[model samples]
Target: MPRNTLVNTGLNLLGLDYKPLTVTIAAMEADTHFGFEQVSPNEKEGRVMAVFSSVADKYDVMNDLMSGGMHRLWKFRMRQCSAVRQNHVVLDVAAGSGDIALGHLRKMGDTGRVILSDLNGPMLHEGARRMLDAGYLPGRADCIQADGSCLPFADAIMDCVSIAFGIRNFVAIEAGLAEFYRVLKPGGQFICLEFSRPVLPFLGVIYDTYSFHMIPQIGEWVTGDRDSYQYLVESIRRFPDQKRFSHLITQAGFDLVRHENMTGGIVALHRGYKL
Candidate 1:
């Protein structure tokens, strides 16, 4: 089948249209399965690339709306924690909108270099355009199409690797983590910013309600596409919990793995070192 056709089929299978009957059928089918096999890395990458490509123009706006501009504050905090400095070489995987890369440049000065990478061509194109509009020199930043699970850079080449709100979309989280470890210099840091379940039971229930109900409505009103937003919520729900994710990082060769929950665990930042 043609790629677009296949993507549409997959979306249908996921019941993105918010039809009550379709959702009921999908849930019944899923419950019947004993255990689900994880989607292949390539398949997952394709889904992510297609989704982001279709939504690239609205990506930043949706983020601002959904997070109420708190995403920026969270990213700023990540930069400060990263301790990026002059002459440091940085790799930003899935660097959507170039926000974190721009933040690093602002702090690290002209001597530092940042490579902003994403698997989706449209996202990279938009990111490059935004960088140029912001007066960033082409030499100071490199925007490329690359998969996080298989970074193209040489091993041990980067001082820092960061992914903000992007890690959970990886086709194979473990492979991506291992790639982060491989690309980092010894003692180099690996950092991820992603959504996490709220810890308090009451808060968790409230958050889930909002995510499942209100988020899709907002997505339909704002983006004219509710399916993508629904998928976003499902993917987050399916992602590993904080402790399991931290353990996966350690298994992938990161040491001293630790995570900090932010905004009542609505978002969390996980950090580790290559050493």
Candidate 2:
């Protein structure tokens, strides 16, 4: 059986209903942003999950084709910022296809533990499959289905928490950051890699055209799903810029917060610490 399958089974046996609880809590709040539109917080997760589930099988391929393999370089930059130690414990939220988790594993020697987590079961399954194919020992990394706003782990247990291109999809970005902060050990790092406002003057025009037009077209051609990728592009536009997001990180009780823009600010890597 797949690792994610075991994790899900354990969740079921424990009767932990993370999704509905998160949605219910979010629904109690005011309207939240979902892509370019304002939607009930309860609706955002379902919509995001739908998108991930639809693309799980082709996610890796789409990443390569969409970014021309630049995402690998971007993630490598994130790893450099992470400075993961050999025996540290890392939690990768919204792990997706496990690219970030795999990088963490490579740096974290045999004793290190990497928890690959995602809210969508299918995506976690896909991530686990990739981990196995990469020859990762079964115990070196564990798969978990979890909510970013409400991680099941106890406080101050993780050495580092890293999220890539995933925070923008959260119903409540602050809430998710708070949860991430809660799980980190003292002086632990929180590294977020996400799309940011493009800095180059004319690049925005070209990027917008490609995102709004070519992206959905590519999604339709590759995954037979256009709406999901459309949402993806819109969400990038809707997400807060680097300075604003760094502020959010600080608000979540992380100190020494800072961010570095990559590729002329098309993407940014935000770093903070629980001091």
Candidate 3:
């Protein structure tokens, strides 16, 4: 890596401005995973953003195509577990297209609010637009361009925190989890709906075959971006499995963390409570 690249990374890692933090540069330059490829932590964010930006308009369509529309059902299960009540505040991180956010808005009653956040501006804009199209009031849902690793919100304020199909893209998974924990009110819920390793060996075989072969091809035909889909499929494999992820939630200071696997474990909904 270039010396200047390392300097910039150090600044980001330390949450500082342009001042060079040379002391942390060596430690911060360790390569992180971007899909199956190793990339600088700084580079991985841009790469992931590029991938989502390329597919922002087509993200919903591709989700339906790849999951056979089961993504909706999985998200429904996520909402069921979310258990958001009237007057509660929800912060949905990396909230791509706002499907999960819209679901909450409908159920959270008129007084309740949801904040939809995404790192990619295009993805955030798409999500905000869809929420409006669904008849949700602008005040009922707020859209912010934010990063999961370091949210701009105050501590212990959100009644529920969520991320759907987006956590695996984080360059610092643990950091993001800590931020979730930090932002949630005591007794708040943390709901994560994500793709996971298949439990059935045969299902794994079929899934791998389809994901490695067909998903990228489908992406190319639909969004004219095969490489982005290729990286997304690889990212699911790189993410920690159900048990490991549950442990991570626990380590983030949550209690009663558990996961329910859907579609033979191809998707998992992990719920935790901040007590």
Candidate 4:
């Protein structure tokens, strides 16, 4: 039941070429989902970290190009739902490229603090660099390499926790939600902006075709990494719909859970309060 043997079995079944490697099956236990397939918990984390590391340099520009700037609007909408105030302490988990953190900093004025964290070191470094380049002083924001499921902060300390387009990548999303709930103070807000199932049937069909077919090509052109983009598309498809995701928020000790669909449900903004 070695990992390589399992992979080779699949290749043999599918009539595809197989390459040998040293990774063991003990590292993959079929206990978690990585993209659309089940993988070991440890394997999923390494794979996800590798994906972000591979794309860190070109992530921002490629995001603008791929989403046609709609990601900006989505982040803006997430910020609006945050209702952040001056002196608030916010945590932006999986804050790749610092979009949500930057938006929160602008609203927080001089006294607020935003911590940008990601599992991938390169992504966190890139986000911190972007914050510095934008004239945000070192005091206004801090960057840390951390996992969403196991946040390193104290309990009930953050005023707001926002994650944009990052939750679906979690190996154990419910664990992440629990961590978010634990780190947020009573009455604090949790906002998530992420890809979701499209409401319009026709649009969903077209979106699926374009995402599966064109996105990898775009990723190749932009970052020379098609497999990473392919994983992203598959992960989005495998994420729960809004209703189910709302249930998860409630299960994690959040109250007043609600979600707003945007761009015909191509993306959604989910908000909840720790009460």
User: Cα lDDT of all candidates, in order?
Assistant: 0.75, 0.85, 0.82, 0.82
TM-score of each: 0.84, 0.91, 0.89, 0.88
- What is the per-residue lDDT of model 2 for residues 28-141, given as tens digits with 9 covering 90 to 100? 388887788888876887899899999999999999988889899999999988958998888899998899999999888777878888888988889888888987747677
**Once superposed on the true structure, which residue ranges of model 1 sit more than 4 Å away at CA?**
1-42
State which candidate has the highest lDDT. Answer: 2
Per-residue alpha-carbon lDDT of model 1 for 1-275, expressed as tens digits? 11111111112211222212332223223211111335544455556677787778999899888878999889988988885789888888888888998988888876877878887777777878877887764667777566666565667778899999888886557777877898788989998888887886699888889889988888899888887788788788877888888999999999999999888888889999988
Error of 1 at 40 (Å): 5.4
**Model 4 alpha-carbon miss at residue 40, Å:** 1.0
Flag regions of model 2 displaced more than 4 Å: 1-28
Q: Compute the lDDT for candidate 4.
A: 0.82
**Can you rank all candidates by lDDT, best first?**
2, 3, 4, 1
CA lDDT of 240 in candidate 3?
Answer: 96
The number of the candidate with the highest TM-score is 2
Order of models, best TM-score first: 2, 3, 4, 1
lDDT score, residue 178, model 4?
87
**What lDDT is reached at residue 89 by model 2?**
83
